[model samples]
Target: MLGRRHLLGTTAGAIATTSLLDRTRAWAQQQPFQPEPGATLRFLRWSRFLEAEDRATTENIRAFSEATGVPVRIDSVWQDDVLPQLSVAAGIGNGPDLAWTLHSTPHLFADKVLDLTDVADYIGGKYGGWYPLIEQYGKRDGRWIGISNLVIGVLPVYRVSAAREAGFDSFPTDSDGFLRLCAGLKRIGKPAGFAFGRAPSDGNSFCHWLLWSQGGRLVDENNAVALNSPETLRAVEYARELASHFIPGTIAWNDASNNSAFLAGQVSLTNNAVSIYGKARADGMAMADDIAYANWPVGPVGVPTELHLVYPFIGFRYSRYPNATKALLTFMLEGPQYERVLQSSAGYVSQALHAYDDSPVWRSDPHITVFRDVAARGRPLSYAGALGTQAATAFSEGIVADMFAEAIGGQVSPREAVARAERRALRIYRS
Candidate 1:
């Protein structure tokens, strides 16, 4: 479609761009960061992100290293690897300067983290203000012990074509409708999926939203155990019925299984991060256009309740490079560098800063536009309550996921499952 001269010019332009990027990386890597007499910044981050975004992060970190003379070392680990690594590090009071993890790891180790109130306050004052949920996720008592980094949009990804065949022309808008739809889906080979195992993130997130949307909560705003209640009873009963339509082996599924299930067309519906949909589009997979994302179905409460697994970076109290660590986080979260991270992620990563909610990534794709406002909506793990030692302990213990799993397993009655969960919660709270 191009003339020889035009093709040559385009090739030259790409070559020049590559050359410039290579030079930039070389310069950044060469320049040593030594902000002060004794300064070093080490980051432990999840290796998984949009590939280009991870590259951008590495480059940005190198630039930070160059600018501050603080040799920044980024140790990338899998999401699953992060928490255990952080736990051991916190237990010993020694680890990477910035411990990156999801859920309530920060709150679980708040006592071992350096107070970052200044970091939080400065960012809040400069960028309008911190989101209400970000404060709860990052703060300990009254001090900010962690830097809430970003959110990955978690919502329902379903096959529209399959839904149509299942005798539904539109997505379910509420829990009861959702139940009937799943039942219909089961009539066909395709089944709705919300992981039923102790499989952590996806399972817990969906079950919690299921409970919360039904006017149930693990704890109230007052930090009281709200797991055992009439609302929870109804939720569990609803969940038990819904689980009947789940795909086989959902009970043993880890996070990746759902993605595969959705892609393989074995599932008509599933709760997943944008990653699932993003991957389909990126890879030009067969099922790409057939997929659509939707909000969590509403419930009797008439409010949309959703849970997102948030990865917040916390500076350990034992870090000798606390100041540098704080600066690194602040740098990543602000200005052009932050925007670059968001842009390169291609709608996969959402920001805590409300101003950044207008990120163009979601707008890039029509189907994914649902994720644009998700950052402002989804609640953290400790939602409907506080992120504290008790709540963190319960989440880390996987008791909540177990509760829902128990209800669906039908080995125990829904009431018994909640009672068991309540007993665990009371023990956690009392401890």
Candidate 2:
């Protein structure tokens, strides 16, 4: 049963009222291979992740069925709107046999999930490679609960030709220079100089790096909240300043929104996932002469900029077929399935070790090379402590979004927003 609070908070409440199990059971039983004569394998994943166009994730599953002679079942669920409901389902032991989610999710389902350390070890030793970034995030208290097959990061993408025309030799080297560059572009009438997206998550993600760049810590080793520090305020102020030059429709932008603006030549430069590069190329957005990539700019901390990555979190509590679950994950990591997922989608990079070698995915593409370079120096946001997801959600949906709004709205001073956010953040930490 969905809690009243859960009902009031999200659309998941509505899904809870529907009958999900009967449909799932029937679906699972209908698949080609039954690992056990009486058992079936069901996969709960983001529908968008296994899109009709994203043939790799699907094909890999199909190949798994063929190779292992075990039938695979898929249940596509949207990550953002439906994951909470799925979490509820998992807690009650009704979740899918295999799950796909962010690195932070397994903690929420920790007890209900299998510790994948042994499985990861078994697979990595026998199968061959694993994504370095995914492998790192899969650990909790030094145990692996999931294996992320996809390791994706964001980079600052720019138009070298347009940047040069704006009287810049290259993209600015630091956050201040980047701000000045935006201001310069506005002075010359580019209208949109920078893109810090307005979605709750995007706002939070961009600010994390911004704060880090300015030497701001959201939390310290003592597990105390640190958003109120002066350095963090300055970082907020800088983002506020840059927000002023965003494309007219930026506030309405979600993750994919900026990509369209960039492809249409409405913005000069912005940070984005490498996958967008594939979209631009597909749309014929002028490759040879227009696009380029760079490390997202450094800030006051002189820190290397990094984009937040989402890793796959698999659990065991809901899986009736543990051996099959292990088998599927093993297949994802060490087999041809890994390479297939990389090439299955445009700009989808694999997380497998040394997978980039001799692969047309990287070798033939110059734009991708830029991202590969950035990944080498990237850092995960400080995982303050115990409640990684809650802390992350608060920072993103609350502090960052609120400060960014105040900055863009020009209502409260950025400093005021920062101070207010600090107080609120402290509450989150203390709670």
Candidate 1's TM-score reads 0.89
| TM agreement with the true structure for every prediction | 0.89, 0.82
Q: How many backbone clashes does every candidate have?
A: 4, 4
Q: Rate the local accuracy (lDDT) of all candidates.
A: 0.79, 0.63
The most accurate candidate by lDDT is 1
Using TM-score as the measure, which candidate wins?
1
- List candidate 1 segments past 4 Å from native: 1-34
Q: How many backbone collisions does model 1 have?
A: 4
Candidate 1 deviation (Cα RMSD): 4.2
Q: Please give, for residues 1-431, the per-residue lDDT of candidate 2 as tens digits.
A: 98988768667634532323333344345433335544568777776742533565665566566545578888776667446866677767886788877546666666778777866776566555554555555667788876766656666777777677767888777888888777766666664433344553344456566767787766776667767778877777777778776666565567776666677777767666765576767667565346777777787666575645666658566677876776666666644556556655435443445444445566656767655543355554543344365555564455655665666666677778777777777777677
Candidate 2 whole-model C-alpha lDDT, 0 to 1 = 0.63
Residue pairs with colliding backbones in model 1 are 33-69, 33-70, 34-69, 34-70
- Tens digits of per-residue lDDT, candidate 1, 24-118, equal 45544442222354687678998866787888778777766665667887899987798889889988877799867776778778778889898
Lowest lDDT 10-residue stretch of candidate 1: 27-36
